[model samples]
Target: MTSTPRSPHLPLPAAALLLAVLLTACGNQPAVPDWQANAHGAAERATAADLAGNDRVARQEWARARAEVARTGRPELLARVELMRCAVRLASLEGGDCPAFAPLRQDATAQEQAYADYLGGRLAPEQAALLPAAQRAAATGAVAASAMAEMADPLSRLVAAGAAVQAGRATPAVLALASDTAAAQGWSRPLRAWLRLRAEQARAAGDAPLAAQLERQIAIVETAGQPAR
Candidate 1:
């Protein structure tokens, strides 16, 4: 028989080492979860589609957000939803065809007043003194006039009232009353911001013919004497 050609053979230890290296390489390779990765990719695609003016996709995103809010049952998230809804309504008003959101406006105003009252009662007399004179008078009147007013602190009451005003439930007269009181009591930056935002929202919602109208109203409020409630 012809001499058998010897097959090349590695030492056992070397072979084992090579096998371990191959196994390690395979183990180190990143494993992709195809379903999860695909889902993420699809989400990115959906976002892109939404940005490309796809109303359907945009609505789907909104719906998802709404569902999340519902599932979480967070009041802050609910408030955001309400705000977004209001914004959508305002934006839909093309050529002045938008429906009046009177009820929603009223609700907002109520909420603002409640917040103002709560804040007002919590403030110190010295702090209250920084508020506008008219506002002080209004707060006094609110304190004296309210029969069921269990609100002990003037500043807290004022804050709650301010919150109502900011919510758009309060008329300009009421807002000015609350604002004057807060200002005289030593208006905080937060209170001022609240008033400004309320005025801006009123203008944005087209409550008046133009933003100028809202500005004029605010100016009048800032300068004019307090009205009798």
Candidate 2:
């Protein structure tokens, strides 16, 4: 086969050079670290298992995620992984200090320290600016718990609800919003948790009927996946 002659201005390597330039332009996004990518995916799975209330599975997944992130030997990154786990657990109402991040705290950034405080329900309004975008408004108390219904991401809204609950700011409207978000996401475990709190709130408010209704809802969510008799 007769090959087309190369133009003097465009040598054989010119096509390859052009391809590299075009590829570079198309790949403007920075390359993600392999371990970071793997760790991120594992972290997501861990949070999912947590929301499903599968503690054992969540633990296993979190370990995998931590292992991946630990490859960097970076304490700040490790601390972030710990914080992510703690945040999910907090949202699930499984109260516990982020002990894992403590030793790493010295290496954590100012923003991370602020996040740790926020997760512990101690963040001040001024520190709210350091929190994740999803929780900022809630942290600042600029937005009512009722306004949680307006948050777009289900998981983010749930996390914000946890912050509100920790801060003793979870109102009836907040409970309702959290319950709805959990139910919509089919996160029955969190749904039950939020409903239980709502029931407690109802009883405290002397609304026995409302409390009873919430109790029934909890039961339904609990038995949703059981084998039929």
Q: Which number leads on TM-score?
A: 2
Per-model C-alpha lDDT, please? Answer: 0.36, 0.71
Residues 135-206 of candidate 1: C-alpha lDDT, one tens digit per residue: 344343333324213344333344334433333344455444444544454433323443565567667677
Candidate 1, run of 10 with poorest lDDT: 11-20
Write the residue-wise lDDT of candidate 2 on 1-229 in tens digits: 2223222221111122110111121144655557756675677677778888888988898899889878878887677778777777776676636788899999987777787777777787677777655567677754476566666677667777787778777777777888888899999778988999989989998999999999999988888879878
- Predicted structure 1, TM vs. truth: 0.23
Q: Which ranges in model 2 have alpha carbons more than 4 Å from their true place?
A: 1-31
Every model's TM-score: 0.23, 0.83
Question: lDDT (0-100) at residue 213 of candidate 2?
Answer: 99
